[model samples]
Target: MISLSKSIRWLFCLLLTLAAAFPAPAISAAAAEPLALGSSEFYYLAGHMEVLKDPSRSMDFKKALEAYGRGEFLPLPGTLNAGYGRNAYWIHFTLKRGVAFPEKSMLSLSPSYTNSVKVYVQRQGRSPLLPSSFSPVLLGSDVPVAERPVLNPNFVIPLDLQADEPVEVFVRVYSKGSISLTGQVATYGSLRNSTYYSIMIQFGYLGIAAVLCVMNLIFFFAIRDRLLLYLVLYVFTVLVNNLAVSGMSTLLFPNHAHLISDYMVYMGIGAQVLVFSEFSYHLFHDFAGLWLLRYIRFMSVVGVLTIISVSLGFYASVVPFALIGIIILITMLLLTSKKLLVSMPQSGIFITVAFGISMLGYFFQIFRLIGIIPLEPGWEINMVEPATLVHMVLISIALSERFRITERQLADASRLSEKRAVEIAEDMTGELRENKERLEVALAAEHLSAERQNQFLTMLSHEYRTPLAIIQGNLDILAINSENGGEEESQELQKMRRAVARLVDVMDVSLMQNRMLDLQVVGTSTIICADEFIRQQVDAVRWMWPERSFTLHSELVEESVFGEAPLLNTALFNILDNAQKYSPCDTAIEIRTWADGDFVMISVSNGIAGISIGDSESLFDKYRRGACSHDTSGAGVGLWLVRKIIEEHGGTVKMNSAAHGRISVGLAIPVERGETPYCQKK
Candidate 1:
């Protein structure tokens, strides 16, 4: 449970920290500057060239120039530039034969200032690129080439012809930036391929979401854990975020392109908030995050509609859309900041913190963009930013811990099984050795042993009583269950459990008396509603066997104490459980708690006998049931375990007796100053 809570806490911290502590976006991101375009008008030139079926007839430098020399720009058929980041998209363009050159026959030029371009001529794995400025490709006609482009950053030289032989050409646009592409590009032949490639890359994340969602569902079926519900929501949010950024929705869901692109940011943000919030709430029992979560849910509805309205209203104009986007974005952010995970369960708070760091990184990007800070482009804010990756890694850690806890549990069980196996094997081996030694002396008397076994069986009265008692209780349970069991049946069940408990007590006491092995008494932890347990224990002792009048009192009642509530209840119950056991039928028992100097004392005094100051020290010893009372039912181990437990909790156990035979038992557990009466119980 602790391990589970911790995983949930880290995830919460990460998510909460993001929503709460995210730094404000930098100024530049807040304010967009109008980019003034230069005086050059865009030149859109169109032309066509034939694709050559034969490689021998392929265009080299001479053929391209020969075509260019005729009139129009030489057409390189079937060339492609798919997208900004990926280089996989194939480009197919044809050039007239002899357009390919050994030195400077044909050149592919990209504008030097293009922010999003990387070009390469078809080559095998390696390509020499040119410098940043005026970099143009000069194809070598002498080399045997493959189908891909030679990756070159520089494409500066001009194309010229060696001869007029007509040839076909093909080139590829590996990637591109905002800068202009001039000099030459052939007529486009595969619009379908280019569009499909863009769409598929955009939808890649949808595939990712589908996989994660399916896995989450499978996990839900297997584990039946509510965390999987949030996981599914989380995966869904990532898919929506991916869709908006990658532009798949623009292609596949074109009718909702403008709407989807604009509103996806809001959906992505809100969905992520929901996933993280839900995860934390179910994980941590704390309700501090409740109201804030409610607020986010309420505002999210408004934010979504506003996005749809504004985006639809302002699609043609960048200003209205951008301004509306900012308003909704800020509002959305404000809503998430309140609850997050940190507000409720500290266990899940790390997830929030990680997200917070990532948010800070984003704010930095926004600041730079808005001109609040000066930061380099392409190097500073990006998807690969350190903060973002770290956040994802933290979340992964939380996921891994869940698996780790389960693994540890399995490993522990396996170790216990192995230990038991070893013990069993040793016991069997020892028994065999003992039988062999006995056989050496008793081989001839083995037949006489049968009669001895019968005599031993006849002497079993002492050994059979406890089992007979248990069977007696079991028979009572059978009779109760045979009828429609009401209070009577419940009493029978309680008797059975208590019978089993008493038998355990006897075994434990006998084991201690024999001292067969070294023993370490481990403690147990239990939940307590402190006030109620104390009141009930005191009241029950006061009322049961009412001739023993008992008083209940409290100076400071810790409402909730985590350690061994039931056992403590049983210990106090032992006090009460014993006050009833020892009190004079007509005398009184006093129960009170008050500040006794530095200690808070909970003492139970009953007018009874069989206890003295010395017995206080030794009466709690196992199997030391005193003869001062007719209570043969007392196994004498109850107070021993009680003494051990309370002393371990840093408290003392004391006993007192009067000449009148009145007795009292007092147990004090140190209540440290300002210690949480109820720190969360493990």
Candidate 2:
């Protein structure tokens, strides 16, 4: 048993000796090849470097060097992108001078937000055994700008190299934000030129951003539009975030460079997302009541929380949230703006272009941060700055378009209102015209009815006149026959004759009135001297009232009036009859004729009893009578017929009531001037 155990121990010892003779395969890998500095302006060190993730963050410079010597560090195939974490990363690369390399060189590391960066350089020929051979430089946001070895916004380490000698560079970085590294080895002259170019570009971007901010700010004040204010704030946030990302904040605010680099960058990102979302909300006012608005509001809250978390020093935790919120917000805005295209074409197109550009920029940046797109040399400036500028311009145009659209909508509404009012007015006018036409038709029908009634009355009067004449003839014969009978019979027969005579007179008056009522055109008219006409009418009245006293006065200037002879004679007879009937049996009726200007005047004066002054004019109305005529036997249409007939002859008739119960009726007719006469239907 002792001999067997001895053999096993010898075998284990032999295996241990063989394992110690060769290093592990991991350590057997070849070291990174040294890059020779050439006449090129700058050299990218990412692909040429080795990386080691120090999760414990306890590894010092010596340990990093030891690990690199053992080839434990892995070669980085591309840019260093150790996403958001509290981890530390160690990067190592060897740089050698070429035939035309400059004596002075610099190692630049980006971005500036790294919490701590320590660089250790050891000349290859002398650095393996002695710690003193290594030169150390400190840089990062944690290190004050003034205290850094090289005064630069980003971490810059100056290198002293000997001719034909290679030097090893080791960088240890720890960050509380997204950990990304892009290193460049440049000569002094090249670095200066690159820095000047970067400064010029940055300043140009800043100038554009400032102009946009100020312009939108002015627009906000001028128009009192909150969308412009939100746009201004969004643009300002973009400027701040971009400055922080590019490390220009260090130069702008030297005292608070660390704060800007660490917290404000994330905060600015959150603020940009918040403000841009608000701008979108207001920009898409037509969609304010849509269900998508709720999602936008939710994203806005996320942006606000991101800002709050970053302010509370949870920058690394909130960075991804802020970036995600921006993506969601931009995507929502793009889709929403596209939807608006149909309703608001100009505004929608402009905003869509703006958001599309912004989205492209953010995608590039996010992809780079997440290591999806590797960072290359000479590609230091991301598309974000240019995209932001274009975005701001297009967004401004979109806002102006929205304003124009709003104004157009208001104008359209006003025009619509006016059109509606006009339509209503036209409707009312049309209704009034219809009513007026109806009223005209009714008036015409009433006038036709009056004419028909006048024609029927004329026929009835003619019929009654024939019968009354027959009765009068019969009464006359009876009176003659009864003259030989009893005195009572003779008296009765005389009464009957008087009654028949009164009926015949009434029939005559009725016939004349109806003729006047239906008179539209006279068949013929003749001129008559006013003096002769008045004298003839007065003689007829004196013959009718043989017992009554009558007088005629004439002061004519040979004036003749054109009229129908029978109508004029009837009008004069009615006036005379009225005067004789209304006056006392003992009073004398006076008739006068005179010529005045182009008219002939006929006047009849009579003594009236129980006639009020107010009732004088009403006597000319048909069926009108005076209080004193209640006991008299006469139709009341005599004066009305007189007035109608006189008016048809282009004349006027008026009654004047004088003191002492006296009334005078006057007729004025225009003298003939050898012109044709026309008449109108009543």
The clash numbers for all candidates, in the given order, read 86, 0
Q: Report the Cα lDDT for candidate 2.
A: 0.76
TM-score of each: 0.27, 0.56
lDDT for 210 in candidate 2 is 93
- The models' CA-based lDDT, in order, is 0.46, 0.76
What C-alpha lDDT, on a 0 to 100 scale, does residue 181 get in candidate 1? 28
Task: Report the C-alpha displacement of residue 124, candidate 1, in angstroms.
Answer: 42
The TM-score leader among the candidates is: 2
lDDT of 1 by residue, 553-598 (tens): 7766553445655446556766776776766566667787765655
Worst 10 residues of 2 by lDDT: 21-30
lDDT of 2 by residue, 1-682 (tens): 1232353465457435544552232322445677788878688886677789898999988788778667688877666776777679998888888878787889889888777888888854685535566788888887777788776767888877777788877888887777878888898988888788887888889889999899889989989988889988988998888787777888888877875575667777778778877777777667544545665677688778878876587767767756755665665566566667777787888878888899878866765665555666656676788888999999888888788888899999999999999999999999999999999999999989977887888788878878787887887677667666744456556556655654554555455544555666544778776667677667666656789888987887556788777678778988888888778888888887877888888888888864555788998998898877888876787888899889998999999975567889999999876632332111
Provide the RMSD of all predictions against the true structure, rounded to 1 decimal. Answer: 28.6, 21.7
